[model samples]
Target: MNKYKLYSSTDFLNDDSFVEWLLKSDHDAEMFWDTFVEEHPEKKNEIEEAVEIYNHFKFTSEDLTLEEVFAIWNNVKHKSVEKRFSFLTVLKYAAVFVLVFTTGALSYYLYNNATEETEFTIAENKPLNFNEAQIILSDGKSVPLNSKESEIKYDATGEQVIIDNDTIRQAKKEAEPTINRVVIPYGKSSQVTLSDGTQVWLNAGSQLVYPSVFKERQREVLLIGEAYFNVAHNAKVPFVVRTEHADIEVLGTSFDVLAYPDDKMFQTILVTGSVSIETKSKGLLSGKNKMVLEPNQMFYLDKESGVNYVNNVDVATYTSWKEGMFDCDKLDLSRVVRRLERYYNKQIHIKDPLIGTYKISGKLDLKGDISEVLDVIQSFVPIDWGKQQNGDYFIVKPY
Candidate 1:
């Protein structure tokens, strides 16, 4: 007997087999659904609607509560063209529920009871622990690069990837555009040239998710941690960088974005050209919540206190990391050490709280060893460091 013969969109959403097929986890489930869809063409609309919801929500039956189910049903009922319907109407109208699902674009959907906009989380389930930098292809294949600093270049067609000396050819399907991801763990960095000629320098402990080829309408990429972008000039198709808190839009601009998930503040520094930062509370197309930044201007947002402001500053203070150096303009010692920890993949603790408040100024050549870098920092501040038994370093008052 075909159990899914009379199944509605809601029933399919509640079924585990359907979810497995949607996630492409079970081959048998995929075959079953394919054959069932062919045999039961009447349910094609229902399955399409359910797939849209599943892709946008990424929720399973357990994630949805009874009240939430009722809400979905009520939403469908209210939007249905037929004012009157039976109890078994199903959730076919959910496809028209004003959800956002663009191919190869950063997701901006509703969540936490489907009330507000939910940003795309970079590494919600997976931890960043790869020793080597890697590129995760759309087909779930991971290509690892074993260099301290890797260079990646995508051809104009986005069908070929050149990683250092090796070249990889990837087949593209027009129906399903590919979205590639680059993950640079601690102690490593990567420079990627997108298909559109945009250049991006990804810092350590950072990840960037971008499409293999940009769509005609726009070019957008999702960023976590820090990156410096020299975007290509394409006024017809604006380039956008999306972080957890804000989306930076620019036609062709050079900027630095520091948006580490663990960091309390999200910052954007415009080195050249102009860009607009839009928070999640406001729509991207709307100008009400957009903060425009001119060259040499910076936009800062404190994720914890919900406070944000703009300041004019030297662009080198924020962008020198990509040039194999760190430029400090009276930056805090604690902030400097944090970057060192990520760049060296080592743990360092400040035993005294007051030491963290010490301001440091100057430039640091990051190509040297951690000990050498610490020595340079020591020259700027009165601090001494000792190694613990576990290989971790601790900062204390000078002996």
Candidate 2:
């Protein structure tokens, strides 16, 4: 059924799926809307008005933030209401607004974007100092989680944070959503339920920055390591996961993103629905600046060469870490070792680079000790491993 049969032009404009249809970003959205218009012929007028309103504005991140665009939009809407004019009628008088806001905002963005980006870059380079998992609130308060796999949930209002058995209330002094961060150290993982009810499984050695509540315009989160997101459905406000290399946008979907700053590659595996990835082109080998992925597909970006590509993949292999299991499907030995290092909080040095290139596949219970997991891997491959004097494990080719 067409869920948006009763949506007004304004509602359609706010809908992420509708915008996706308009932008032709997802084939599923295009198909669904085509069927919707066919079934609800009477909605043609509303749809046309929405299309017109949407097409009239050409705002990008380079020009203005979503808040600024919304402010200008509200001004136009107010004029329409005061004059008792149609949406299009008010747009006729919005030329000056469009020009002035666009030009001024673009100039301001150009002036400050570099500094803003530099600040974040500097922060990203800093080392993680916390020994345990913790949640840092906007009020500069830090709530520590001692559990190895802690569960942190927020109420829809974003003011109440439920960490395990305790509920902590935050003061909401302003209309804007308060920013919060979840930091997970090595050998620890956490699950976070955002204010919007989106479930995020934060893996070991990860950090997630999100609002206590989502804004009307969008729901966005910044991820420093890896996380699996089961985004809540909010057609009116798209959910976006921002990483160092790419911005992934989805109306509602389940996906796993691996973008550890130190890792050589960035990856996104879609479990269901659709997502669009806009890669930040920092180097020459970036294949495409923008792409859309379907379910069961993976988007991979090689940071070293600035190359990215999409391919079909078994979603389970990438997302299983969240489920207390590590499913390896013919993956490289070095890649598997890196994940183990994070999971177990122990350094495993591959003494022979040739041993790291060997492909191995298996499902190992991550709950067991690191040695037990390594024994399982050794059973499947010809490798010898032992602990070093420095208390780290070393893998070598068997004599």
Per-residue CA lDDT of model 2 for 1-399, tens digit only, reads 556878888989888777767765467877777788898989888999999997787543232333364456545544544655465664577675554333311110111212222111111112234567888776656778989999999998888999998999988757434777788999999999998899999999998888788767767788889999999988888888887778898999999999887788899999998999988755222233889999999999987666788999999999999989999999899999999999988999999998999998889899989999999999989999999999999999888
TM-score list, all predictions: 0.68, 0.68
Give each prediction's root-mean-square deviation over alpha carbons.
19.1, 16.2
What TM-score does structure 2 among the candidates reach? 0.68
Q: In model 2, what lDDT does residue 66 have?
A: 30
Q: Give Cα-based local distance difference scores for all models.
A: 0.79, 0.79
lDDT of 1: 0.79
Q: In model 1, where do residues sit more than 4 Å from their true spots?
A: 1-132, 282-288
